[model samples]
Target: MHVYSRRKRKAGVSDRGARVGKIERTTYALGWRIHTVATQGGLPLTYRVRQANVNDEIPTLKLLIEAVRLLHRAGLSIKLLIADAQYYWKDFFKLSRWLGIKPVIPARPQIKKTLINLRVKHGFIVEGDPELIRQYHRG
Candidate 1:
């Protein structure tokens, strides 16, 4: 069977552009995106790859649509898809549901209300390290 492949790439400065701590790389970074399809019985069928300096949401949606089209032609259309939350957006859910495919993705933790409200609702819970001296003093 003939399989199709597509590629896209994006480049940008790394958040940690050359420094210590969380920012440790003072350099450019390239992000990648890859999508693949296999038979209903789990056999390798086709694949594509794309890279982007930005986010994966839009690219992933585009690639998924193309893959669905190809799979339909091959009689192996996708049904249930498991993916990361990075690709979880309103449009992604809309398109996949429209295609009759169920997507299982965890909600992004950053959007958790309890976590977001911690500092504001009740001052941050700052815990101080316990030193051996403190334990000895208590004893």
Candidate 2:
């Protein structure tokens, strides 16, 4: 978010922390990168604020690791992590699986259409994750 202040320098905005990044979808402004992890019910679980110019994928890995650490320490487990397309990365998927969580992120917009086509050609789609399949059978 771009904070508009009349002052020559905003408080606490260092040369490294705050930089030029996109805001309002059409404008690039100086601000911090804000990333959030939320629940399926739209509740925020954790977040990170970093330099605005940082790449979208960098802080996400840290967020996921931190989330796993905090949740597991509290006697909870993350079965699935649903993120947006920007979070689609092979290494991220591998790390999430290693952490015992399934990453449900689309690689591209066409993935939805492809999956739909598969379901149309075949009556049902098979579940690849063993844990999810077992849960389906148990229910």
Q: Could you say which candidate leads in TM-score?
A: 2
Please, what is the whole-model Cα lDDT of each candidate in the order they appear? 0.48, 0.63
lDDT for position 61 in model 2: 85
TM-score, one value per model: 0.49, 0.63
Q: In candidate 1, what residue range of length 10 has the lowest lDDT sum?
A: 115-124
Which regions of candidate 2 are displaced past 4 Å?
A: 1-17, 23-26, 109-139
Residue 89 C-alpha lDDT in model 2: 63
lDDT of 2 by residue, 81-136 (tens): 76644576678878989999866654443344322111111323334455544443
State candidate 1's TM-score: 0.49
Which candidate ranks first by lDDT, i.e. highest? 2
Model 1 lDDT per residue over 21-84, tens place: 1111373333333455444455645555444343456456776777788878978678765554
